[model samples]
Target: MSITDKNLGSKAIQWQAHQNSNSEVPENTMAAMNYAWNLGGIPEIDIRQTADGIIIGIHDATPKRTLSVPEADQDKLISELTFDQIQQWDAGVKFGEQFRNEKVPSLKQILAGLSEHSDRQLYLDFKQVDLEALAALIQEYGVARQIIFAHNNHENCKTVKRLVPEVRTMLWIPARFPETAVETFTHIRQTGFDSLNMVQLHLPDAEEKQSWRYKLQKTFIQEALQYLGEAGMELEVLPYKFDQEDLFELLDMGIRRYAVDEPSVFVELLNRYFN
Candidate 1:
């Protein structure tokens, strides 16, 4: 479970493509995922479950804007709709050109596709209650060791670990409030988390007219890394934007894991330095 002990360190960038839709690159679709794999970057996808227990790839709890559920019916939660009903809504039309005609995919479909390609790793973000079932599916596919489950809820992490102990888990801390970084890390550790999923903004504030905050953040990162190293856990940092300098700084600190929206760009940078 230690950073050094775990085989989770990868110089490859973890790319989270947006779920396949019209305007943005439909993330979590077979096409987008394959596109990422072909670029030699790991694919990070989001998952939610239908009321009937079928797991689907999506980021939002409601199918409102993404799927164009009518304003009157937009309040329906994913958990309240059956898989068939959920699939009836077009998850791709809203985005227009970028996604064109892609469709939302199921968890089983994504896993099967991943199984065919062995060169890439999967970063599965569980955004629903059926995570227990998803965990079972992952184990059934023998991909527990190849996928990392990211969840904001501590209990979800515990559930994944208990159901699939061999699989790695990262605690996803929301960075909406910048002041809670330290407290979040503490909670992660207390929850027996194996890794940290923090945002770039959570880094320490800089002094006026100086990059001192950057330096201070770097020092704090090293300390946290060391602490996690000693405790047999890993640290995965996700910057707010695709900044190469930030990635390089973290890499220089001996942190090899990262999540980025632009996988192609980050992977190119990583290959330049590490490959």
Candidate 2:
């Protein structure tokens, strides 16, 4: 299959709901995944391992931010606690009382939930977890092709690819490293990371008008795109916020895939282009 097929299903333009569509539901929770799935969009979730080696979806190092944890246990790390201990905290109360019963979902739970929809794909953000174990679990669930493993760590991308050759992997360029974005792509080409299925480019924060936030020069973007196309790798953009001008510019440049936090806003603007 082509890189696009490996990474996502057949769609003229596709988006992975960043943090599982956090704008409408709690980020990285099953509720968020279900919401995105209902909308026929892919859910991008962050994964980390518990003390007992069970992989779970969560963004931060601690549950203090997303869960309703007390001040006394604010510093507790997910890695330091067993899955059972972490499940005691309410994952949705902080987001809203209506979603109060949402528990921090384990990777198995996420996979099982996904099994129901064979057409849907998942974007798994590798935060801190065993590559082999994670790959094995995905294989066990028989949904390797339906997953796109994403990570900022190049080594982790390579490792996961080595473990599961069929599973798609995305290497996201850090927005903080705008100056070296092209250099990073050049390094990927030179080093022969052929196992890589896709590269995620971060567009500068539209609301934040800082010079450093200016992601990459246009020339650099073109060069990177040329190289990626030649290498048979797909490019997915992560614009921190939705902007009409920026989205159109990217569309003009031939970028069709995106990782968006608010799918509704992105889709509304996208519809304008087609309709």
Residue 141's lDDT within candidate 1 is 80
| Candidate 1 clashes between residue pairs 3 or more apart in a chain or in different chains | 1-232, 2-232, 18-27, 19-26, 19-27, 20-26, 20-27, 22-95, 22-96, 23-95
Q: For every model shown, what is its TM-score relative to the native structure? A: 0.79, 0.90
* Candidate 2 wrong stretches, greater than 4 Å: 1-11, 206-213
lDDT of 1 by residue, 219-263 (tens): 656777777777766566666453566666667777756656666
lDDT of 1 at 124: 80
15-35 per-residue lDDT for model 2 (tens digits): 888984468788988888887
lDDT by candidate, in order shown = 0.64, 0.81
Whole-model alpha-carbon lDDT for candidate 2: 0.81
Best by lDDT: 2
TM-score (C-alpha, index-matched) for candidate 1? 0.79
